[model samples]
Target chain A: MKILFLGFGNVARRLAAIVTDEGWPSRRGTFPVEVVGLFTASRGSLAGAVDLARARAELEATGRFDARHPLRTDMTPLEASRNLDYDVLVELSPLAIEARGEPAVSHIASALARGRHVVTANKGPVAFAYRKLAALAETQGVRFLFESSVMDGAPLFNMARVALRGCRVEAFAGILNGTTNAILCHMERGGSLEEGIAAAQAAGIAEADPSHDVDGWDGAAKTAALANVLMEADVTPFDVERRGIGSVSVGEVRRALAAGRRLKLVCRACRREGAIQTSVAVEEVAADDPFSLVDAYGAILRIETDLMHPLVLTQEGPEVMDTAYGVLNDLMEIAGTAERKGEEP
Target chain B: MKILFLGFGNVARRLAAIVTDEGWPSRRGTFPVEVVGLFTASRGSLAGAVDLARARAELEATGRFDARHPLRTDMTPLEASRNLDYDVLVELSPLAIEARGEPAVSHIASALARGRHVVTANKGPVAFAYRKLAALAETQGVRFLFESSVMDGAPLFNMARVALRGCRVEAFAGILNGTTNAILCHMERGGSLEEGIAAAQAAGIAEADPSHDVDGWDGAAKTAALANVLMEADVTPFDVERRGIGSVSVGEVRRALAAGRRLKLVCRACRREGAIQTSVAVEEVAADDPFSLVDAYGAILRIETDLMHPLVLTQEGPEVMDTAYGVLNDLMEIAGTAERKGEEP
Candidate 1:
């Protein structure tokens, strides 16, 4: 199989490493695949699989590409995506929550328009236009899979979509944003929010500008995406009743901890009567609840369904590796579908 | 689709209710299917889909059949299985751990021989004869799925088999037996082991004879089944380095609780030096650990794999409804496979 990557960030690079180290997963088994093209907004583009660590380092240090690399290209992602010979298009672009899934949506749509399968880790397309993009994929005879959008590599969406065939997902509550949780935990330990952000940023767990996470936009976007896909809410991130941890004080966190409860910015989506309701706000979780126990870097999702009982899926200390796993798993799903129909990988 | 149930018990009745209330899952959509047959050891057999409430009541009250029942028969499951025309076999037979998955294994083999798909909740076939039974199903071009055999309806195995296709499961540690966890929790709460068994039995979570659970055989069986399928351990429950909570003392439980730890009967299976090692033993979990917070009736499984992060799956207060979902989901999987191949369901 040949592939084109939209953004060559940490996630895309991690996936590239997995395919090179562990090989690509397909219906038959794992095997090597060609990484035909790689694109990035910061570092220009590459035409073939080549060592990218030095390129990323030089771009970070010099704020520009080395310009001497043999595979360097001036071609845009759109140009490579349309002209490249590849069976799958991997979209690992940074999320644009405020833009409401913009260029990423166009990229995925272009790939699906050309009858190519898409495996993405971006939340923009799902939160803003799940139904339309999914319909486009179906119309073009391909798949649009995003397992890393919510909780990286957790497979919560796959559980609802594939393994849970007969059951109907009635509702969900999750601690979706790790940055906010880390901020809260830091405050509980008598530190300020800035200190928490700095700590997380140093650990590579939070971005330099964490306005989206601190303002609950990231959690709201994930909530909208999950609700739109699983509950068919047909809603966007702005539709959710949202709040952030900016209003939560250190005294409040310490008091909640003293009372054997933890303050969490909980993202919840449920059906009330016939309409779907989404919310992201700070809530006090009891000591015994599973959500109260997850660390700052951990995530937990509780799903209430019809036939199956309420299931709680948790992943603690998840890093970039987990997000890359989601991309690879989605690719494997597409390949498995094709192989079932006797198509070449 | 037509189904033949090998053992008509609470689980089978629960599935019947799900199909009747929520409808059967298929490639097309939710639709009703025929429950062509129901076979039981003590209550005799029924030839068609009959209201079984009165029959089950009668069997429990008087332990005999009312000759006036229209669909009543003395036909053995084997006899009915041989002569019946059905697309799938729903096996909810009781576990015969000491028998090493007997009668269930033989019955499932017969169904596979007849080229019929099988969905089972019994652990016997998985613990003792997974390879042979799976091979037989493949030879007959059918599926032999046993999701309920391990985690009720949590979908841990499904995550490994269907979703996490490319990644390999490196190891697993779980509180696989709910009864044992319940017992340990009860003992920690200043109750005796006998009181714990009584509480679980009162809640209908434990069998009348709790010997298998207290002896650690149940957890060992689940460990072996999980290791065999996920890690290719190829060993039985007896092969595990096993111990039961029966030897746990009340003083020990209280002391552990006082020390900010909870003693749990943890079932662990890992690949050590290219060989799978399975063990079930009592371990102390710190207060900060997620396992320390689960209630007596709750279950927690932490799976370690390559690519994907460590996944922790937990289910609390699961009832017969969840197990029924497992069987239905497996049925839907078979139907999905058939639908992909354009075969008549």
Candidate 2:
């Protein structure tokens, strides 16, 4: 299948590598994936435009590539739509929430309008305009899958829709933001709030301007997407009550640890008397509990149901890669089925 | 949608109550499910037959019975097929493996042949003849879902197919047979092997014969289903190395517990050096490990993948209900999509 990748970030790079390596093992053995084109946010050349020349030189010394994937920087959505004959579009562009007229949203919307399936890691499009985008996909008979938008690649979307079938999900609670969770873990281990933030930054777990993750916006975005898409709840990011790890102090962390408890940034959404309420809070988890042992940026979803006991699902590690692969897998399933049906009758 | 039930067992009774009462809340809220017909093996009149009487009593006790949803007994497969006008068949008959050539298989085959989706809790047809049955369902363009055949209702089948998508499952290890797991849990708590077996019988966890579960054949059957259907590894029950929990002595259990370990009847299927091998054995799990905490009939599937970490999923109670619901859910998704498409151009 001919594929077009939008953006040249970490996820985009990994996807490019996986698709280009023919003999690489997929979960189903060595199936080859061909990447026909890549479009990045640059011009001149990634090698020429690199302000960090030393890092570029070190990367070039390895002989992998003198430059990154080719950047079609000047191509507009309309031009790309007419020019590219790709089967699917992989959208990995960095999110732009304030710019309601961003290129990523237009790119995705245009791709679906052209009846091309979209596999996206961008949460902004879905979180902001899910109903419009999903309805558009349905009308065009193409899939608009964004499995990575919620929990990286942990099957959180699939679990809600498929695994917990025939059961009403009353509540969904989890540790969503990895940066905050990492900082909280450090704080619980006797580090001051500032020290923990510094540790997270040093470990590359926190962004330079960490307001999105540390101030609970990231978790709220994920919660909105999950609730709206998976649970079919009418909600938005602004609807949730946001409380990040920024409120917790060194004294509070130490006191909790002394009481044999660990502080965890918890995100939860539930139907209360037919109204949906969501919040992110730092809760003290007991030592023997599973949440206490969730080390780093791990995520756990506790779903409350009526028929059976509460189902607790815990997923650990860097989930972005898994999420990317999940999006690819869904695309494969949808595309394979569609291709087969087109060939039949 | 009219549903035809093939048996009047506990599961069938529960499902009938849910359907007739329309009390079960779906994604669209409490929608009515009308049960048009029911069939049981009893020969007496519909009102007097033991199975029919029990079903009626249960439905009445739950206050879910309506005069519109009448009961029927002594209905042959052809008679019910012609009379009911049901869109789906719920097969909950007592599994008669000895009579492989009997009407249960033929009835199921005919139901699928006539384009009625089949949701079964019966293991007889699937364990012995999955290939033929699955091929028939494919030919008929309907689903043959038997989630309860393996783990009562704990999303085991769906988990393998959907949740763990895009990853090569290297191995599946679990305590599949609940009766044996219950026995082992009791034995680990200082009861003798015989005493534990007796307790299992008293608690209705084990059958009177108890050979199928305790002798490891039950777990072997479930392992075969998982391997064949989930992993797409063509395997039969006979291919598995069956070792029942009966082999584990009381002294061994005591010794294992003394060493801060608990004995569990473990069923494992893996691709070892490119060859699929499965077995049931007594493994000593560490006290602090998740496997050790699986008490009573609870089952856990530790799926090893090519990814960075293994996923451990535990289902705490009767798994058959979840499996049955999974089958129903799959049918709903497939059928719902088809119905919607049929409405379109």
Candidate 3:
């Protein structure tokens, strides 16, 4: 499969390295994936089939990918997505949630319009334009999969879509943001809020700005996206009652710990009175709740379904590889090369 | 699709009801499932295209289904599975761990040899002969899906197969048995061991014998089945290092609770030195472990992968509906009527 990458960020670079690394044992053996195009905001864009391994290595060694390096082109991601020959588009651009899923949404929309399959790690497009882009993908008989958007590709949407058959997702409550949760974990350990944020940044888990991680926007976006896709609700981040970890203090964390509870930024979406009500709030969860057990860099989601009363799922280490695997997982599904029965390799 | 049912037990009866009940909202709309046959050890047998709705109602009311009933027939389930015109077989017989997955194994083997797809709630066939049956089904282009075996269809195998694509399973530890867990939960609540057993029986969660659950055979069988399917181990129940909840004392439970811990029957499987090692043992888990949060009639599975550190999953209410939905979920995947993009009902 010929692939086009919209952004050469950490996640996309890892994906390319994994796909090109012969040492990396793939579930689907030696799947034919070639990097045909790459476009980044600051880094120059390139088109035409290129050595993805070299591209990944160059980007990793340096900080940016130049169009003049080996694979030369002067096309933007949108232009490459329009004119380039590729089977699927990997959109890993940084989130632009403030603009209501701008350039990312437009890039994905253009790719879908041209009858191309899209795999994304950008939550912006899905957070705002899930219904529209999903409908467009269906009309075109192509998949628009973003398994990384919600829980860094820990099978959140796929679990709902494939496994929860014949059951409706009545409600869901989850700790969606890992960086903020890590910071909270630090704060719970008597560390100041600044120390927590700084620790996360030093570990390369949080962005430099850290506003999205400190504010409620990231969690709210995930909640809105989950609500729209799984809960069948047409909603956006603006619809969520948002709260962030910014208000949490060491004193409050210590108090909650003394009461055998943990304060967590939880994103909940439930159907009430026949409408989906969503919120991202800081709640004091009991010691027995799964959230209390979620450690730093870990996330847990509890889903209430019609058949199964409640299902809780937790994953640790929302690293760049998780997001990279999401793109590969979605690509396998789109390529119809998903693992089959009786094939253990 | 014409479906032949072997055994009219709680899980099978619930499956038939959910499939035939017009009022039951299905993820796949009005799925084309025709009951071609049903055979029970004591409830009798039927053949030919049966009115599944009326069949379900009769079984629910009478607790037995006779050939002379409304859906009259003369053929047994095995004979129907071999000779009748059917596309799929639903196996829901009682567990026969001591017999090493008896009659169920033969029944499923016969159906698979006949090129019929099989969906089973019975753990026997999978526990004993997963590689053999899976190979046969693959060679015949038929699916032998037994989602209900491990976690009563909480997506254990499906999650690993369908979602965790590029990663490899290094180890997994989980509380797989529900009835024994329920009994342990009762014991933790100051109930006597006998009372806990009695409560589980009264709730229909445990069999009248209750030995399979409390004796550790059930968890061992599940561990063996999961090891066979997921970890690719050719082992059986007898091979697992087994310990039962019957050995757990109420005083010990209280002590663990006082220490912020919970006693749980944990089934662990790990690939050590290129070989899969499995055990089902009672362990005292910390309050922070997800297993500590798993209530009576609830389950928690923690999977350690090479990519993701550990993925923890918990589910509550292991009722008849969960097992029934497992059959339906497998059937959907087999019939390829699974949810498509923008085609949700």
Per-residue alpha-carbon lDDT of candidate 3 for residues B1-345, written as tens digits (9 for 90 to 100): 788888878788777777767765445434677777878787768777788777778878888776567566667666777788778888888789878898788888899999888999888888788999999998987789998888887887777777876677788898988888888889889998899999989987888999899989989888889889877799988899998988789999999999988899999999989989999989999876678888888888888876565788887767888888877888887766323322221
Ranking by lDDT: 1, 3, 2
Expressed as tens digits, the lDDT of each residue in A1-345 for candidate 3 is: 778888888888778777777766445434677788888788677777777888777777777776457776777777888888877889988778789999999989999998888999889888899999999998986789999998887888777777886788899999989888899989989999999999999998888999887898999899999999888889999999998988888999999999989999999999999999999999999987778888787888889888765778888767888877777788877766332322211
Quote the TM-score that chain A achieves in each candidate: 0.93, 0.84, 0.94
TM-score of each: 0.94, 0.81, 0.95
Ranking of all predicted structures according to TM-score, beginning with the best and ending with the worst: 3, 1, 2
Residue B108's lDDT in candidate 3: 89
List the candidate 3 regions with Cα displacement exceeding 4 Å.
Answer: A66-68, A337-345, B24-26, B337-345
Ranking by DockQ: 3, 1, 2
Stretches off by above 4 angstroms in model 1 are A22-28, A48-71, B22-31, B48-70
Task: Single out the weakest 10-residue window by summed lDDT for candidate 2 chain A.
Answer: A43-52
Clashing pairs in 3: none
Question: Could you give candidate 2's per-residue lDDT for residues B123-219 as a string of tens digits?
Answer: 6677666777789999987778786776676566666566565567788888778888888878877887788789989986677887877878777
Write down the lDDT of every candidate, Cα atoms only.
0.84, 0.67, 0.83
lDDT comparison, 2 vs 3, better candidate: 3
Docking class of 2: acceptable
Q: For residues B135-181, what per-residue lDDT tens digits would candidate 1 score against the true structure? A: 89999989999888888877876767766777678899988788889
